[model samples]
Target: MKSSPLALGLLALGLLAPSVRAGLTAGMQEGKVELKSISQLAFGPEGVLFIADPKAAAILAVATGDTAPASGSATLRAEAINEKIAALVGTKSDDVIIEDLAVNPISRRAYLAVSRGRGPDAVPLLVRVDVQGQPELVALDRVRFARAELPDAPADVAPAAGRKGGSPRTESITDLAYADGRVLVAGLSNEEFSSTLRAIPFPFSRVERGTVVENYHGAHGRFETRAPVRTFVPYRIGGEQHLLAAYTCTPLVQFALSELKPGARITGKTIAEFGNRNRPLDIIVYQKDGRDYLLMANSSRGVIKVAAEQITPAAKSITAKVSDTDGLKFEKIDWAGVAQLDRLDARHALVVRTGAGRALNLETMALP
Candidate 1:
């Protein structure tokens, strides 16, 4: 799975695609709606979907064929980790934040990345809950984070500054994915603009520790490299296990899982870089009619759709314009926090957008 340096160099240049393009159609007809601050999202077996609202400290269950007022058709379940996670991390029940949620496909279990900062009781933990209603911190000791370096800061104060700085180092895991019998976690370093990707082996009953797969510097290739990653989705492309990473500051970056295994160098080619200057905030990959498509939610623009084939090397340039059904032009709304797009059937999807306060928007869109 080794990519020649020549191919990798070409990838670096190909990543810089202009944001200006025409043909994007927007409107309520395209299934656009307002939503609360959506912190995380995932689709369950069948047509069931889940959205995590960390600000609300609750997970909402939305049934199929639902739209706005998702709270009506959605069952809001309060996270049970309020007290337990707090005790484990030695932080206030309110501060023991649940940053990301990962569902195990095999065991049907759920894992949460809980961060407690730097207090005596503050120990970031990777916690898991099985289907039988049992919950425990899985990889507590394996979780290690280097405080980002800050300007004119003392060594001891670096970690604290990094935690307070920006999107990258917020002292929490921004995204998590379960694949190939392992758990992948992405964390941001606020003081310095960077994020680290770590992998934890699965089947917790057998292993007690996980290894740091890659200590990725946020700005390794592009000019604005430190933009913290907004989403990481594991997918198999062309019979190889690869990961599609979307940054809040840059376009998408792809890497083979083999390149991330222990002792492997951190060199990944930029497969496809799309979206505007505002940074792509969310992304999801799903199959429709036996074809794969990458759906991206941008902070400046709305959702952009691209077929998997359009991103391959042969395509050269992938282009699409957003437009309404009536051929009218529509502007992208101010998207906030976290959002998710999930497959509904062969031709449609369920989109959930969450923002500040209690705002939550849900819509159903037909794929083009």
Candidate 2:
């Protein structure tokens, strides 16, 4: 969902100045580039790979060279998604851990990030799974990449290190989405001690900016929290475009697109709070039977489906925590263990979830 820049100078730039996009051929910069950790990812035009390496305190957009047109034919079939993935990563069925899933809009292929071992010794690998459920390593050789840096990112500090740390950054990129020629990223910030949403133009064609969004959690001034947004979608409500973002303790908030200027401190209008303890993982807006709905995937809880008819500019923010329905009707999918989800097409969604026992599986199913 982002990139890491060289120094703090570029991050301080405004809209008037233009700079050359930092480009890298994947394997060529191996010695100089280390993706210590990959928390979130998204794809852009011309096979551009947006990788969020929170541990390294930077985001890198890698040119993967996977420009083939997507089959766009029909849904893919993965008979035993987990077993196949385990074999490809050279890990036993029990040793495999599927972290996240994303479908490329252009290639229509599903990508999975997996860990081969446990704890700090685990090895992470990116696997490309096709329509037939076949898995292959996404080659990083000879690929082009760009970096965007977040200044003053909290360093990954070990408790025993006595405050001295590596890189002054350890923030995580919670979610990523690409739309309208820009990449939208949501995550927590260690430097500012607040949640942030960033809109970066494609191909590193311009400067990058980060926005600090604050919102009230409970009653107006009784209790408030600047929690990080877990996931979000760029959508239009009441004929006006906005960023519909979800935060921890699950508050659905909206910010008008026009108000997201750099250096502007914005307050989100909290529209709905799903529950007290639930955390949202991913959210996608879709249409069905000539009606619109907001499908949100959650953690521990279940998938929630809210009718779009309930979302409107007239809807007021929930200032107080409630026990029941909050002006909107919602339904939970019957299936459990759906850890990750994304829109595959108009009527289908690609999900990566825990399968039998401890195994993981990726499958496409009709929208609820």
Candidate 3:
């Protein structure tokens, strides 16, 4: 197949993408990674990928070394790759569903969260695709890993029927982020009454069930919700660091890390509202001209770039609706179907984008 002009241009930018700069670490030694359960994933410091396990109530950090994805990797169409993955796991193409996508900054390889079927039969598979665009099983046997279990498990509300089959075991983990020696997790319990965040300190010490983060939304300064953060990246404004979290109906709220103490009820400052009925997929903090920007991917409105400085001195909350160029203006990127994204380095972001004919393509592109 011949490459279209658009594909060629994207390839050219990919060639110039930034290289991984993470330092090496002692890859897995003891404390095996139990794949019995998993919901969310995020790359932490020292080439560690934090895996959230709510069943055993533990989070695992596995060592993945610094190997960048092949720079000019030819596209590996999602349909074809899914077939191959199915073959490896003894299933047909229709039986597998790609739940999530994340790229390792250290390896440049993409990780795919897959379910064998759904509900109780929904066995999860962690697969990695390399530069050649080949799918490989991320075998968990004998890898360096550390685990930390959440000391608290709140009661469950009746789960939403699993994906067509009600696979409630794995759908609880909504998002994960790593920053400042802590792994921040956002999840919804079975009860679904409220959402929660967990800041697990690395080196396997303790799990801190984070404070409840609520935001004043909609008009009239009311209509708050405990909707879990779908995806987030740590951002710094001034001298303080904060978790820039996105909730359902799409409100971008910031919660200071210092104030997220255990059992404390905290409210996040609503900085920007993406739109109503929108589900935010991924977010990354990027910089240009020494100015910072927050890039968010959504299920419907495409990818958007928000000026980070707007939030530093923002209103206490944005209670009204915003048009595209209104308060905390958002400029949408022309690229469509970005299911997940992560900053590979300063100049580029690794993305899982929708390909022609319902396929998924993992590629690196210039930062917007």
Best prediction by lDDT: 2
Score each candidate by Cα lDDT: 0.45, 0.69, 0.67
TM-score of each: 0.49, 0.80, 0.79
Poorest 10 consecutive residues by lDDT, candidate 1: 19-28
The true-versus-predicted C-alpha distance at residue 26 of model 3, in Å, is 6.7
Clash total of candidate 1? 29
**Could you give candidate 3's per-residue lDDT for residues 1-368 as a string of tens digits?**
12467756766777422211112234235644666666677877555777776656667778765444446433333445666677778987677777676667655567877777756557767788765667888877767776666655554355655346554443367888877767777767665466677676555543343344433234325765555667777887667888888776557877778766776666777777666657888888888889898898888878889888787744456655457323477898876878767776667777777776745666677888
Candidate 2's displacement at residue 317, Å, is 1.9
Q: Model 2: runs farther than 4 Å from truth?
A: 1-34, 71-73, 93-95, 154-169, 189-193, 205-222
- Can you list the residue pairs that collide in candidate 3? 28-144, 29-144, 70-131, 119-167, 156-191, 157-190, 157-191, 162-166, 162-167
Candidate 1, TM-score vs. the true structure? 0.49
Per-residue alpha-carbon lDDT of model 1 for 200-319, expressed as tens digits? 543222232344344342232432233455787787766778887876644466677767655343633445555346566556676777878777666656665666654443322212
In candidate 3, stretches whose alpha carbon ends up further than 4 angstroms from where it belongs are: 1-31, 66-80, 155-171, 206-220, 313-316, 319-326
**Stronger candidate by TM-score (2 vs 3):** 2
Q: Which TM-score value belongs to model 2?
A: 0.80
